[model samples]
Target: MKLRNLPPLALAAAVGVALTACSPSEPEPEESAPESASPSAPPTSEAAPAAVLPTGEPQVLATGLDVPWSVAFLGETALISSRDDGDVLELLPDGGTRVIGTVDGVVHDGESGLLGLAVDDQGRLYAYSTGEDGNRIERYGFTGEPGSLALGTGETLLEGIPAASYHDGGRIAIGPDGMLYAATGDAGNPDDAQDLDSLGGKILRMTLDGAVPEDNPFAGSLVYSYGHRNPQGIAWAADGTMFAAEFGQNTWDELNIVEPGGNYGWPEVEGIAEEGDFIDPVQQWSPEEASPSGIAVVEGTVFIANLRGEVLRAVPVADPGTATEYYAGEFGRIRAVTASPGGDLWFTTSNTDGRGDPSGDDDRLVGVEVG
Candidate 1:
């Protein structure tokens, strides 16, 4: 959600303007063709059958969310985080929602607020939020079931991460190794991306208790990989390879296959740099084409939610660079995407976050079939 200063005309032309939760009320005005058009339909001919693209419609699960940032599952229920309001809401199977708890000391600035969320096998909940001091991760224990849920006092897992108005990266997930993995931005300072000693601009690995794992790439440090501008999505494939979605400054957004102690070359390189020392992104897109936010891997495909692109891109795990656009310009400014228990994809819209046009049901959660 960084890069907030781009002109609306440029953004609208690059990616269509945000639509309502369901669809666009009016047709978008024609503009100059973008560098690449959204995947087009195959031409029909008597010689051959038309190609069939992956097709699935989004079902709106819940509405009236105020900038819902992340979604995590606790059993069959879904827990959603509201960025500006610091509220954690529980969405039941019947589409009912209830406030489970409000995170204390959240500062809802330009792009900093309550962000990423994760749940462990023990049903413990983890949240990343912006506080007065900086960005912090907190763990909470849940007491009740879906309808009536109560959260315990939050236990601070980690703190002292740099925070800023724009680039405070905030995505956390439990890796397949049973360790906690967190992504942090450069806090609006590009130089911080190259500084390995700083916690900003890196993927951090730690135990559930916030202790550095003994097998970490960096001995006695939590830094797993360095040289990232603002990475907001982390998901592990069944084979244990980690993939992250990152926001680029102005030129490129990246989908990176993360390796331990790898350098991504942030300030030095934006997208695919054939430079010797830097690891290139598996896939790259223009920032206008993809202000990519949250990502999830389901059934061997990586589903990336795009904010500026206004689409859910399904990229096959075997094929990294290619993607099929689903619901392009339909759900509006997708902020978070996660795999549901039933093997479907659940995502949230960000139209209410002072950027896109808000429909009456703006910032809602929608579900789509993945397989």
Candidate 2:
């Protein structure tokens, strides 16, 4: 059955390298990736018989979001996070929205406002947002039912992640392993990306209780991988192949197949270097065309939301080297994309965030059926 756009539409819109291993305290910044890395896991490709992506136009689900940054669903109900105001919105059936509640202690800055959101199996809501101190992760009790959703008191899970107006990489998701994963930027300090002790410029993995995973690449540390500039997207395939999308300085943006304890070259290198020391990106695009952010993988296809590129890009899991573009310049500044609970693809726009030209309903939530 081909899913068509909702009939009663008010408005609609749509949408890393590794570090090398090195010696103890003397580990050089330019060292190649660690030796424990499994060979670069290739994306699921056409050869693997991946499903085709939907070409139909996106269907608008809701409108009037204030600089919305991320979206997560609890069962059938959708929860959206706003950056400027730190409001969590519940999407209504009539293409409208209502405020569930505002998150506490959110301090909005350039790109350092309320950002990523994730829901756990225990019905807990984990939020990654910027606080007065820095970027932090908090767990909130998700209470009440849908439509009447409310947030209970929060427990701080982690804090003091580096924050900057521009490079505050803030995106969180739960891996198939049921662990909480966060992508953090370099926080405007490139050297921090190479420091294993620094939380910036790396993908972090932690238990639900905020403890570092014992099996992490680094011992007694939450840093799963390091040497990233501004990684904003991370997703895993059914086979557990991890993929990440990152922003480059001025040359390139990257899509990488992540490896445990892998080191992706950051200030040392931008795109593919073919250097054995650092892991290379599976694909690279010019920054003007691919400031990629939040991404999702559905049915062996990796869906990416590009900010400046202003397009939704799809890459086959088996063939991550290439991508197909959709809705280019139709809806301004695509921000986040997620697999909807209804088996469709849901995405949100970011035009109202002091950038692109937004319509009356500039920041909107939209979706498309994918089967």
Please give each candidate's TM-score.
0.86, 0.89
Each model's Cα RMSD: 9.3, 10.4
Which tens-of-lDDT digit does each residue in 70-94 have in candidate 2?
A: 9998877788999988888888756
| Clashes by residue pair, model 1 | none
Best-fitting candidate, measured by TM-score?
Answer: 2
> What tens-digit string does per-residue lDDT give for candidate 1 at 1-371?
11112122333223333333343322232222232322332222233322222334445677778999999988777899999989999986445578999999999998999999999999999999999999999999998776899888999999999999888899999999999999999999888888878999999999999999999998999999999999999998767779999999988898888989999999999988878788888778898878999999885678889999998787666556667777778777999998778666778999999988887767778765544
Q: Where does candidate 2 stray beyond 4 Å?
A: 1-49
Error of 1 at 249 (Å): 0.7
TM-score of 1: 0.86
Query: What's the CA error at residue 69 for candidate 2, in Å?
Result: 0.8
The whole-model C-alpha lDDT of candidate 2 against the native structure comes to 0.81
